[model samples]
Target: MNNVKVNVAQVRYREGESVCFDLVEDFSSFDLGTEILSFQAPVHVQLQVNNTSKVLLVHGKIDTKLNATCGLCLETFVYPLSLSFQDEWIFRAQATDDLLETALILDKDEIEINERIFEQIVLALPMKFICSAECQGLCPTCGANRNLAPCHCGENDIDPRLAALAKWQSKD
Candidate 1:
């Protein structure tokens, strides 16, 4: 039951408002599983909430950076996180959260806070995070990061389909 609900009574807030906080995903203390590519600068975010046309909007802003790993090279790099997101949190709706063992749903009178948004941020962590513009990435043959150095496995094996051409002489 690793659930963190912002008990409205504790925080001085209204239904339509925003809040800010310092965040930290402890690399040394937490086991985020194998899927969590990487993290940089911990994470700090500013969240804004507003009600319009009977829909509660949840917006987010990046107060810091998140260093993520490149999908190709598996090397970590700084990734700017400036989220100007707007999503409708229905008075009663379900959303996924990596931190939540169960789905998060909002009530009619609740301020509409959900850790699922954090999950969305995690999901937004680039599918292919490159360390730099000139990153060479890892060698496919030998499983070595090319950004570090060149590998001897540069020679690729010829496809068997093309091997038939080896015996075919030019017909003059």
Candidate 2:
């Protein structure tokens, strides 16, 4: 049950005509993989489709809210994701290896864009998710969240390698 499909069978070729579509799809069924816990709301997609004699061009933006775990604190937080993509789809009689990496082969009159949109969302996800830029991660010694409160771990708990340097500087 894909929510995003654009029918291009009736589109005039090489006329430079364009069709626009806007949809709000329930993304609860789509698995966002391990990076996302759940979707906060329905995904919104805005697309413009154009057909040139041999190629169909689709360009649009996808907006959604994702529940992601913070990398440092391991806390779940809602992250807003917005992605824009432009893809050229070729109307091919047969598949060819020389096709562009980003280009998709059109096999049917209607193009299902749900998979492509999901791919874009996955690619746009950040390598590291953080609740805030100033998030103080858990303390190494006590394993307590530093952002919540300061730990009473000894300030003198310096690395053994650096401890030798500290003694030398104090002697001066």
Candidate 3:
């Protein structure tokens, strides 16, 4: 879990004035509804917050390590992750349609960015995690990990559900 909140109360409401922050937050794990993510190290973040009097412009970079499971081999591996992000925070009273849809409407000067960071991290991950390009997945018949050793199972063993499809092909 990450609890990262930035306070902009002391920042001057000027165009060129900005506040810089360097933070390291400990993150254990988080549930993404579909999958769970575990962090191998603390999240390092560097942020520059600029107040434009109307909106707060935030630009930052995040770096961290993750313990991820390979989708093909189901083996756990350490994955290094680094990403950069930029966001706009507008006051609820000053929000307008002219601003981009990604702008965050804030009711207070204190902004919590943990959720946004998590969303970014999840979006940056690949659709399927493979340990390596040459990873050999589990054998369907014997349930053996093919990456470790070769399997001697018969290759023509058709699944019971697809037996009809095999017979249909043989008919041709």
Candidate 4:
């Protein structure tokens, strides 16, 4: 019944059986956080499910575009995101006591992967968003974006810790 749920009975549950699925839909259901301005298109997911009798191995990649603000210049730009993940889903009856303590439980007939996919997307986001590697950032004195234009601030603004050394050098 879940959005991303897949019925295990529908797949071939053999030793090495594999199934592939493509998910293309809007991502409005999941909270993408404030850093993401908007989703440009549907999130495209390519997944391969492998059955190992005792467990199901899910491996896939998620692709999407997001509007993000540059941390340095605070400019909004379109950002492309591609994330890959691999995980195991074990049946509750087959899981050992130790695995039951730490592993996720698979339902009797279905496996829900909505939360897992959302979590992976969240983890894949960059800690710092920059429009480009050459971004010059804002000037500290006048709050001017150095990437756009050069500021008129003089270079005489030296660190206070080096002021004594500057005076000594001037005397020489």
Candidate 5:
């Protein structure tokens, strides 16, 4: 269910050879809210490998389409995800200073590349997912969806300040 290998042996980097491949990522198991939004990870791990310095420069943008409830209205709408980033990964850094520059270090046998790239995509996601800015959330009084229709209750409700006085009059 987790950590499925998305990119396997796609990134080919010799001591000095440049290689790039198309990356397509889909989320079959990624469930945002009881639905698979296909906004999981990189569809393809398209990379340009420089064999000379053992660096893989990645440049690509992905489209993530998912339905998010409107923050105000609570209505669901397709939220388009436009995420693009350029990553520089240097392998086998002989100099200690060059070590930190690498985004992620992997063993020779490790064929997983989703962790490094996936983090970037996640950061691109909106902090608070809403369908739109002007979404009128569910009505507070009758529990009606205000976006769909107007509530029967008046906006200016009965004045609670006069409730005690009304109670006194009712006793008479």
Candidate 6:
């Protein structure tokens, strides 16, 4: 459904010719191992294919919104994701030692790009999903959400095992 057809004859024969494509694809959900990654909006892709004689360079941009949980606050929020990527595709006949090592060797003129698009999106995801910079997280003493309100627990209360460490800290 999200395939782009590049006229290999046109580009291969003519070195400077280019083609462009715009795709809007519905990818409602994807299985992310233990979690089901759901999207808040449809994925939009824009691609430009350029012929460089040796290879066909594909430049692309993807935009979408996904639901993510805040790492500290544990609240769900919509995360807007935008990513840009560039790839090279060379026909099997034109593939050299270095080109084969780096570029994708294609047997045909058509390319199915949804998998590649998804890969870029997944790699661009943040290691820690924070809703905002001001997230206060939860109180360790009472397990209360600190972002909503301040906790009334005594800050002086310390575990007995950590008391020796606290005492040592106070000395410095």
lDDT of 1 by residue, 65-113 (tens): 6656776788777777665565554434333353134323456443434
| lDDT tens digits, residue span 1-172, model 5 | 3242433244444555555556566644355453344443434445554444545555655555655656566556777777777766544443246655555544452446666656665677665667756677787778788778888776676778687789888999
Please report, as a residue range, the 10-residue window in candidate 4 with the lowest summed lDDT.
28-37
lDDT (10s digit) by residue, model 6, range 1-172:
4443444555656788887878888775776664566899988888888898878888989999998878788888898999999988888998999988878788876666677778888988888788899999878788888999998887677898799988999999
Whichever of 1 and 2 has more TM-score, that candidate is 2
RMSD to the true structure for each prediction, in A, is 6.8, 2.9, 4.9, 2.9, 6.3, 4.0
Model 4 score (lDDT) = 0.77
Structural similarity to truth (TM-score) of each candidate: 0.52, 0.81, 0.76, 0.81, 0.62, 0.79
Clashes of each: 1, 0, 0, 0, 17, 0
lDDT of 6: 0.80
Better of 1 and 6 by TM-score: 6
lDDT-wise, the better of 5 and 6 is: 6
lDDT of 2 by residue, 1-172 (tens): 5567777766635557778889888765344454535788788999887875556677989999988888887778888989898877776663356655557877787888788887788788887889889988888788888888888896777898798999999998
CA-lDDT, candidates in order: 0.53, 0.77, 0.82, 0.77, 0.57, 0.80
In model 6, the runs with Cα more than 4 Å from the true position are 1-12, 154-172
Q: Which scores higher on TM-score, 5 or 6? A: 6
Local lDDT at 170 for model 4: 95
lDDT of 5 at 56: 55
The numbered model that scores best in lDDT is 3
Stretches of model 5 off by over 4 angstroms after superposition: 1-18, 30-54, 93-98, 109-111, 157-172
Per-residue CA lDDT of candidate 4, range 5-69, in tens? Answer: 66666554577888887888666534346554567777788888888776677788999987788
Q: List the residue pairs that clash in candidate 4.
A: none
Better by TM-score, candidate 5 or 3: 3
